[model samples]
Target chain A: MTRKILRNVGVPILSFVLLLLVWQWVVVGFHVASYIAPRPRQAFLAVTQNWSALWPLILGTIRETVYGFFVGAALGLGLGVIMAKVPVLQRIVYPVLVLSQAVPIIALAAPLVLILGFSVTPKVVIVAWIVFFPVTVNVLDGLTHVDKDLLNLARVYGASRWRTFIHIEIPATATPLFSGLKIGATYAVTGAIIGELAASDGASLALYQEHANANLNTAAVYGTTMVMTAIGITWFLLVVGVEVFATPWQRRTVARRWRRR
Target chain B: MTLLELRDVAKTFGDTIALSPTSLAIAEGSFVAIVGPSGCGKSTMFNVIAGLLTPDGGDVLVKGERVNGTTGHVGYMLQKDLLVPWRTVEDNITMAKRLTGRVSAADREEARAVARQYGLGDFLRHYPTALSGGMRQRVAFMRTLVTHQTLLLLDEPFGALDAQTRLEMQQWLLQVWRDTGRTVLFITHDVDESIFLSDRVIVMSPRPGRVVADFANPLPRPRTVDTLIEPAFIDLKTKVMRLLHREDA
Candidate 1:
């Protein structure tokens, strides 16, 4: 099992290393303009050299995204379970939830900025809004997909509602909940970036964008984009790790797929 | 004294009446068989008696106490072995006891003991998907036993098995019934199985079912598969077929 986990982890890490090699060798070989594609070493140094400048902004984005992701996900999960179980509430409330999303998040971001004003609140709101729908839908599917035969078995056994939910519904729906969390994690990363971009004119990655544009530092612009990509990858891997721990069953399923191949 | 008695028990589904005022009395420790054509309320009669359904109007008495609205007090084995796929074989057998939170260490030990006796000792930790159909049926039967209910309700428990497995299970069931001596009300469409397993057999009409005839199996105790060829066994089946309006060789 340990070997299997290591092997799984190894593929992505190796891919990343090969990517960096291509990036470094390509820049060196092509003598690519620094503004267009800085050497891999320059991008690597960017994080450590500018730690004092970058840490605060990075932390600030993380804080907003994490906060919004959880708040929205928690609300979505609770509401989704209720909606799945109660048809009348579902009928009354579902369209509102659906309609809320059809209008794009960016379309609403401007008004949000106008009202909330260049604060952490706008970013958090973006994260929350983005994360909410996937969490709700996945959770609802998970909760509803509990087996009918199991329900009947429980009924025949005269299991109490609390016991039934704890034993049957929760375990039965574990995979779906993890799925919701993964979506929420992806949304959270996007939400943070959007929040940072929309909120302040001269701070964080967006600030780097401004400086890079004014100086015509195309490599710096690409470098900032590279940083963003790294953050996204880090956050996604974190979610996947948590999912593996939370649902070993999923890991077993993945292992089976690997075997089949 | 009757262990279970159904008085004028009827069931209706919307416009269709399934059973019409069917009454039955099963004595303590007796094995009673109910056989009828497809679509007959034979299964419904047992369902009503098992407390899975309420008669449109009537009373179900178990040990002289009314038990129609009571579910879980009677253990029922359905045609399909409804074992939870995620649960292990041992867990499947004691599922009801675990669910009700009454399955204690002693109860589980008893469940394991029963499984071991039934040739599933090796596969207790195995999942349902790993087991064969015959093995699944045995686990289902073990589940009914673990419920520890005095009245057992089985609806075609061996109906899904192949011929060989069916015969094997029928023998296993007979031994289990003989040893446990739990009052059993088994419903089936198979005529031979009805005669082979029952102390008394009740024959029913197709729809709006009623007990058209009852016969003491008259076969000797410790009956086996070979008993099907006995003169008395053939005699009993021939009589039931005549009542069923079917020609017999």
Candidate 2:
């Protein structure tokens, strides 16, 4: 277990430290001005010194992301299941859903801010919207294409539609659904930041980023970037944790062997 | 008494006929094997009997009542084991009872006992991925039999196994059939398997399949591997093969 942890947790930390060293050298050696590009230490100091101002913005972005992720994932799964079960609904709505993806999220953000009037609602909606398509597509694919022989066996045994859905459809769709969730998890944070950038009543991380960039406070920009990366990593890990527990049967033996070593 | 009777049952998919007025009856506690070449609608016949397909012409009467276009009458095992990979062997075996609200304490006990008898006691907690193809089929058979359905439609359940596993499973199946006394309608292309496991062998002709011949086995009970070398077994095997191969000619 210790060996496994060293490989997993230790290696990443080592690589990250090496990257910071390189970054520090590159900034110092090139004699880059602080206003254009800051050293790692400067960025760290910017985060620590400006903690009070950055904290609330960070907290706000996290909230919007979490709320948007749940709502979007729920809606995506529900609609995807509906589409899989009823082909007519899929036929009517599928083209429209595809078309919506073509119109960029940025284009919608301005109109959404105008309509919703600079509330958290717009931020949450934007996050949810960005994550929806992948989740829906994955879930629909999983449900429709379950193993044919297994389905026939269920039919012959007189399994009720509900039972078949529960036993066969749900489990079969889990891996694909989790794939969608992972993709959505990454997008949720970006969506919230975009909404905040478009229009916000007060300070959010995106607004902080805009101010830092406008003032050429390069360290503060990097600090905001670091905070967003943290949020994205945490969200992704949370989804992965759920996937690990939800589908124990799908665990890889190769991974288990590595853990054992 | 006849447990299952098909009366002039026919089926067509669009302009193509799948089964052509096929009729047969299965007696209670009897083992029957149906042998035919591929595309002879052998599967379609089993599907109709299992109530997976509606016959275009006549009736499928189970215990003298017509059942058409409905399922769940017989325990059906397909070519693949079809055990849900996510479920353990025990869960897969007892799934039917759970689905139908028959999962009483007694039924659970019966399922455990059956699993034990089938040599799956040690692996009850293991998922299907942990098992061999033969072992998976054993679980599938147990799953089918544990439903306590007296009629079984096994659509080439052993067709996927290796030669050695298939032979062992054939003997295991015979023992189970002897013990349970369930009426089995088995489908196979192998003439040897048909004659070895069946009391009666039914043959079907080419596409839009129809029953071409039906003959009772003259072989004795408690059959062994030695039976394969016996002249009587060879005679029966040859007869069924001739009937099947003639359709090709």
Q: Using DockQ as the measure, which candidate wins?
A: 2
The models' CA-based lDDT, in order, is: 0.79, 0.88
DockQ of predictions, in order shown: 0.32, 0.44
User: Which regions in candidate 1 have their CA more than 4 angstroms from the true location?
Assistant: A1-7, A10-34, A37-42, A111-122, A200-261, B234-249
Q: Pick the candidate with the highest TM-score.
A: 2
Q: What is the TM-score of chain B alone in each candidate?
A: 0.95, 0.97
Which ten-residue region of model 1 chain A has the weakest summed lDDT?
Answer: A252-261
lDDT of 2 by residue, A189-221 (tens): 999999999979788899898899999899999
Q: Estimate each model's TM-score.
A: 0.83, 0.95
Cα lDDT tens digits for candidate 1, B4-95: 88888889988778898878888989999988786678877776776667888889998888888667668788778987665667777877
Q: Give the runs in model 2 whose Cα sits over 4 Å from its true position.
A: A1-18, A252-261, B102-105
